[model samples]
Target: MKRSVLLLLGILLIVLGVVSIGALKREIRISTNVTVSKSEATSFRVLSSAEQISSWMEGITLQETLVEHPENVGSRYRLTQVDGSEWEATVLDLEDNRRIVMLLTDPRAEIHIEVELFPSPEGTRVQIDTITRGSTVFYRTLMPFAKRSILKSQMRINEHWKRLIETSIESLVGEWSGTDASGSEQLFEFHFDGTADWKVSSSAGEFQLKNLLYRRNTLSQPQQLDLTGFQKGPLAGMTLFGIVDLSRQDTLIYDAAAGKPDDASARPETFSESATVYIRIR
Candidate 1:
């Protein structure tokens, strides 16, 4: 009877081991592309260039720059994160204003980042292909979970890129200032109940535009918003909507699709029509 019991336990263990192995073998893949339309190649070219890489990729800020000069094919650069951890990457291929591929590594983790750029009806379509392969038994087991989490985070990251790209657009063509463009002298001062201010604006007449967004972090109660809208004409009913990242440096304005006019402020669903100063900052 003891021998039969031991044999039964051994079979169950083998079946569990088989199931675990099958689970680990399953793979998850995610891909995303964002296009900035009608943009000159210069914008994409400058971003991929070595000189301004850090401006867009904030993570590079935490690393120590161990290599300098143009990162051409076969060139390598080393960086160390804040915790004294390190990553070494080498440029594997480059085509001016078209594509770039690099292999990234730290002592424990490895990722390949490929950036491809092409013209689109709206602007330039930037395809970022990221394949992270882990070498150790632990990281290999963790890769699929990591990949799933990272893909969700990518959506938020794209929104960040949208804010930056919108900023770039405004830098190229000045903002559609309220008074001159829309004939409204609305003294819009969006002082959040906390500390942070950054937004995107596009001025195309008679079109709905999502002008501003703000977020705040507070311990006393739920965060809040304060806006002073000034307009008496057609845009008096226009509304503003946005998302605020408590941990981020900027807010994302949910403008309508790039080609279409922005959404008007009066949408009852997921929009607030009134603007009032809950607290005055003297």
Candidate 2:
């Protein structure tokens, strides 16, 4: 009876091993996206900066470069966590201001990540795709759980980046004084509360254009400016897509279309002869 019982226990162990092996997945993939109110160049710069990694990436205590390659391709970085765990990341591909692909590895698993940025109506769209494969059977079985955790981390990182970029918009706050095409005195007041107004003073009289809203993407070439919510005039309730040159803090080179373009490419590429030149008054 003792030998028969031992043989039955051995058979049960074999069955359990087979079941565990069958549960292992070959790989897991995760895709996450975020729309940030910054230019594509700005988003890519933040994402690729090693110095900023710890600020947005959760639990990373430190990061150091192990290998350096020109243009960032083939560069390797070592990331250390608070718990003393470490991971190595190697840049596999890079497209300046466009896309980047990385290979991340640890003892237990390996991950391939691709990040792509595109110009969006909001500012920039960031897309992150990752494929995870385990080096051991134990980790392979845990892929599903790891995928969920990684996705949450990615979303958190994106939010952190968005906040970082928004701070750059503060430079445009305050009032600017300029003149319209007819040489009428023009005043633009940009409030931190996200509301703005265009006030005009002419021999006719002083009147304010109410219900105006303004947004800026400072990192874009020629810098992007959008004005919406015009309460009166021909552009009432329409967005006027515009560009500004802020290279000089004391002056602003501002140009906007009289009306929204059917396509973004049709927007102004350079300051026109009639572009309004504004001097910072506050």
Candidate 3:
């Protein structure tokens, strides 16, 4: 009886050892797919914007770009969490309106994320795959639970994106007129195809913004708006990083920092004294 008991104990020890080794060698992977009722171009514009991302990504307070890239292929950002933790993310690859691969790293683990977009009958199909690897055995042991948590987080983020996109698209399709701080008459025409035109008339000159692409995030209290394209006047290719307030009917409280400020951190926090009030005309 003693000999048989000793053999069973030895077998249990061996099995546990094998299990621990296997877990250590494995990396946690999570993949989720969602379809949103928006075009691929619009979806990419929103996804690539750090401003829109901070609104939909839960717990993220800020995302500051350390390096800027026109196509975002080599951009790097520092993401600050609500709890004050920080993570660094670098863009590994990008294809216009198609695919994006990014790597995020922290003290505990490294995460590789790849997002692929496809045009679907419903709208745009987004596939997100994340692979997380821990730096220590203790962290690795917790990865099984972490995988489930990450999956839930991704799903929730996608829902936020869907709601923001749908709400903004419905609310911002018309002509709006306002007066800027300089007393210039400003006219903005937003089209359903995700394009817009800005015409400003002033004593100095008349300026027109052409080939503009607008993306909005209505998830936050004061909605966020971004306008990117070339300008026909002195500003050239300045992008508008701004906010919109739609609490009152037929009114839009617009405040924006013209051109790319020093960084995303330079975006306006609230309606400044220079805020332009716009009334919907059409």
> What are the per-model C-alpha RMSD values against the true structure?
17.4, 14.1, 10.8
Candidate with the larger lDDT of 1 and 3: 3
Candidate 2 Cα RMSD after full superposition onto the native fold (Å): 14.1
Name model 3 segments beyond 4 Å from true. 1-25, 53-57, 168-282
**Top lDDT hit:** 3
- CA shift of 196, model 2, Å: 36
Global lDDT scores for all candidate models? 0.46, 0.74, 0.75
In terms of lDDT, model 3 sits at 0.75
lDDT score, candidate 2, position 132: 81
- Evaluated against the true structure, the overall lDDT of model 2 is 0.74
Write candidate 2's Cα lDDT for 1-282 as tens digits: 999999999998876665475365657888888887765545665666655545434688889889986456787889888999888888788665578788888898888888898777787788888888887777776765676787888788778877875554334555689996878889987754357888889998888886577778877888999888876778775678899986653477788885653445545988898899988665
Q: List, residue by residue over 1-282, the lDDT tens digit for candidate 3.
A: 999999999998986775586476557788888888765555665665556635434688888879977656677888899899888888788665677777888898888888888878797788888888977776776676576787888799878877765554435656789998999999998764568889999998987876599988888757888887765555456767888887665578888776553455545889999999988665
| Tens digit per residue, CA lDDT, model 1, 138-165 | 5565665576676866666555655555
Which residue pairs in candidate 2 have backbone atoms (N, alpha carbon, C) closer than 3 angstroms, thus clashing? none
Q: After superposition, how far is residue 61 of candidate 3 from its true place, in Å?
A: 1.8
